[model samples]
Target: MKESGLPDRYENDAAEKLSPEKQLSPEQQDLKNAIKAFCIAHQHDEHAVFLIEGDAGTGKSIVINSIFNEIQSLSRSSDKSSPFWKTDNYLVVNHPEMMKLYKNISESYPALKKKDFERPTTFINRMHKSGKKADIIFVDEAHLLLTKSDKYNHFKQGNHLEELIKLARITVLVFDEKQVLKFKSCWSQGLLKSLVRGLPCQTYHLKTQFRVHAHQDVLDWIEGFCQKKILPMPQKQTFDLRFFADAQDLYDAIKKENARYRLSRMIATYDYPYRLDGEDHFIREGRFTLRWDRSKPDEKLPWAERPDTIDEVGSVYTVQGFDLNYVGLILGPSVLYDPVTDGIRIDTSRYEDGAAFTGRDGLQDPEGTKERIMLNAINVLMTRAVHGLFIYASDPALRKRLVQMQASRDAA
Candidate 1:
């Protein structure tokens, strides 16, 4: 029997080649220069720590790639005598899809290879044993750093970030608190203070968004909606942001959009149990049905870059570090609105990400961790679309509530 995998999806690509937005905004450029300078100045010192705090679409990948190319080019141009030429830099990403994508294009980047791109713990373990400290380590999706050993990792631990700080002469980390999907991530600003410990450290925020061409109004709605902040949904925007009354309508629209424009796909919350009985349709409601693409551990093709994945709905693990043109989001039964509280309350028992939750070294509040993961998972899917977003709720009350929220402004 072919085994099934996890259910979920997310927005932001960890690999630069898969990133749609290549051009860097001014803020991203400035951050790149700052990052370059920090690395250059600390070529021989192991006390440099820089944190880049940016939400999704702040051109973090673009900036990191630019600096990498610049450094590699400078190294190549230097006549082999310059210390700049000897600097060894590694660009690491914590997401699996991102790592897989990077390996496919690693040959083009002479400075980095499929081997250099790795999870935080593996990178930490390998570097610790290398004897020679690396000149620089660039961590993308830094918030996904794992703090414990599980089935995937058997490495001895302290913390992933602390190892990078100790072993690398210079470290560049880009993180957003919202992107902390799994568990045991110390990527927060407060954690940075304790980790750096008086080292010459600095933090930079990337404010210019280069993803999601949809208006800020749509983005604002996504934020408030996920947090259950009781805000009205977007009425009008540069791109489509609408709720479909029926799942069938949204599914039809998604198929039409895929036929017209390539790369459109549906991503859903972990509401349904994995249909492992060799069924083609993983999700079915009345006339609406779809199959989520299960992760093939050996598959090298990244879902976002592959054109054949249109028939397969993506999971949070596969799409977390990527983007899509138009997204059809299914807010699963795990999340719903309570009329009494008039706010969102996640049914923790219904959520499916508990298997991935690591807790505070296996000593955390399981219920709380599950809720956080569920919210982050849906938030990732809701924000995946660059041009448009269509949403369908699994819970009837929540579906009606979203429609009411969208039409509330009209009532006013």
Candidate 2:
């Protein structure tokens, strides 16, 4: 079924409205100005590239959309004869894999169809054919952009960043360096930092945690951990598993707290070895979800049609771009980390063989690899809530860490 045919529950309204209250914070405002200035100065330039960096829940998506809106506004305000007014056309190239929007688009508009909507190359070619260079090209969740080398045989030398820049005169890349997982990149923070080593393009960072409430103090603690490299104590003696236990319990809790804090409705994030089966409460059935991990080649998670009721668990990827009033995170076993060793590691061996599997950025700190992944995952997870957070640990060590953190806070 096309987008219209799909149920309203699955529809995403993130980009639907420009919030009346949507005013830029100082940091975001500075970055917005930089984008505006660059476009103004390079109105006639062949191409320009910008790299936007932030951790999860940093408002990167909204910021990028706001810039486009501003560009549109400026175009209208400028004199018709001014080049700025003429360069009003823009393109927002979202990572369809990150959001299932493209699939719906292709189903709705057959002319703009792609066999594999998740592949970056599909969007790359579409931009290339647009003919008129876009005023701005936004690559949301850009951390997933594949490196030029990883391109399939058809695009052996394909670089989504370069192709996107080629499609637009001004290209704005939106990404969280900490969320780099699915795809390797040559246009990442490391590459941009080095490439723009002495360049004049201005860079800005968003430090405010706007998505989460400071009520429970968990958001602050998590932010402190991510930015300061120190894990702060939780507010309780035991990590609350309210939302992660079972669907009925989570629903009851949400109903009880609905007056004080609203829980986000069911958002089933597709992940390895686990995917929701429509109405079955099992992972094997009609759900159309797909999980891409090399390790689980033999493993096929079940998927079914949408259930009448929503589920509580989600993958880190799907939930990163969204925020719930209160979130309950179920940390999958694929991740492994050690607090004492300060060692972070991900057993990416399941994805590929030896060094090649983890890619370049992944090579460092292979032992506690999941720590950084967990760090990033937790950052995305905890920040998704506005009022409160409850982390449910499946792993013994992780559970211990949560318990200890809560104990320390109680003792204090």
Candidate 3:
């Protein structure tokens, strides 16, 4: 029973996790106020879909949580017979780490957590079985929601995205298209329109970044870097960007910094093979030998956020949808900077996301599909740092290309 992936002790620990209050930026507050009004106004509507879109550090989570808490407060204040009071709502996420975070948080807030948090696949399957649907659903990290039916979710009839939105009268999604890490996940204007072809829909965007401080230059640099846009040569002064020739040195620096200040992490590309098992396995690169985090024996905080997990490296799954004080990133073999083309080239064969390569859903473009997935993964890893980011490129030529591109004095 313990091997089923959901164990009794896990549930017990999940019930004890804490969620603190978040101070919202003016933009996050406005968005939350607007969405709260909309939800309350149409509390009885059986078919409304609203999209709240933003890139990383844009306070999407704060807005979502604020709106949810406000709604829950209003609901409890009203009499039970009121439509707003009796309506059931949920906050669904696709990432397991985030789901665990919210579920543990919900443990503290019973008024909100009462059947209120879940993964999309699990929520959809339960709704199908019980013939029940939510009045409203808040989907964070909607881009990570899967479409392809995996081994565990093969019983579902169609796309989980479609099934999810349809199960709610109003589905509010916080999304970023570029954050789609796997080939099966998608969140786009086209997808929303197709899912609800005839229904009128509303949209919102959060432009102000609330995560990383002094984040615009870092974001701009990332945009230009990923798009292959040759902007003015980058300066290391802004947000502490540095590229290193050695992976070990970069990791050691991150560790030293972490000792002074916690919450720093080492994250890397999925160019190396990874599995959740093997408690003893370690990734050996350069002088640094690091292990991927083993599965959580219980439902608690994520490996990336835990102090004890300092030695274990994080991949796309553990680090996405979260921020760190500093990040030491290793760009692996699958993504390489091309000297001939003067741009980056994604080698699909070198990537290790096996699900993307399989023709599981019978729609496989091979190179194009895997290339997009790999690029998206890198894009996510690059943006997770709040104050500092150091990088080491495994491919020497790519490392040299990066050095020449920014060629910061820090490196010199």
Residues 1-412, candidate 1: write the lDDT tens digits.
1112212443333354343235666777788889877876767675788888876766676677677766765665656876568667777887878777767766666655566667777777787677767777888888787655544576567567777777788888877877666666524456667888878877888876556776667777777766865565665655777787788898789877766665678888877766544556477766787787765667887887676777777878778767676788888888787888787788978866555555556544766766777777777787677767888888889888878777776677
Q: Summarize candidate 2's per-residue lDDT along 1-412 as a digit string, tens digits.
A: 0011222243233433122126777887887788777767766667766777776666776677666655554465646765567453543444332334423333433222233223446556555566545665656676666654553324444456656666666767776767654324423466656543543455556665555545334554666644423355544422232323333444445444433433343332222353333232332212222222111212222111112113434445545566555454444444445666543334443221122224455444544443354455556665665545555444456556656656666678
**Candidate lDDT (C-alpha), each:** 0.71, 0.49, 0.71
Global CA lDDT computed for model 3 = 0.71
**What is the clash count for each candidate, in the order shown?**
7, 16, 0
Q: Against the true structure, what is each candidate's TM-score?
A: 0.88, 0.67, 0.88
Clashing pairs in 3: none
Ranking by TM-score: 3, 1, 2
lDDT of 1 at 351: 65
Q: Model 3 over residues 104-187: C-alpha lDDT tens digits?
A: 676666467637888788888889889998888888888877766666655355577678777988888888887876656644
lDDT of 2: 0.49
Best by TM-score: 3
| Candidate 1 ranges beyond 4 A from true positions | 1-21, 80-83, 109-112, 184-187, 275-281, 359-366, 407-412
Greater-lDDT candidate between 1 and 2:
1
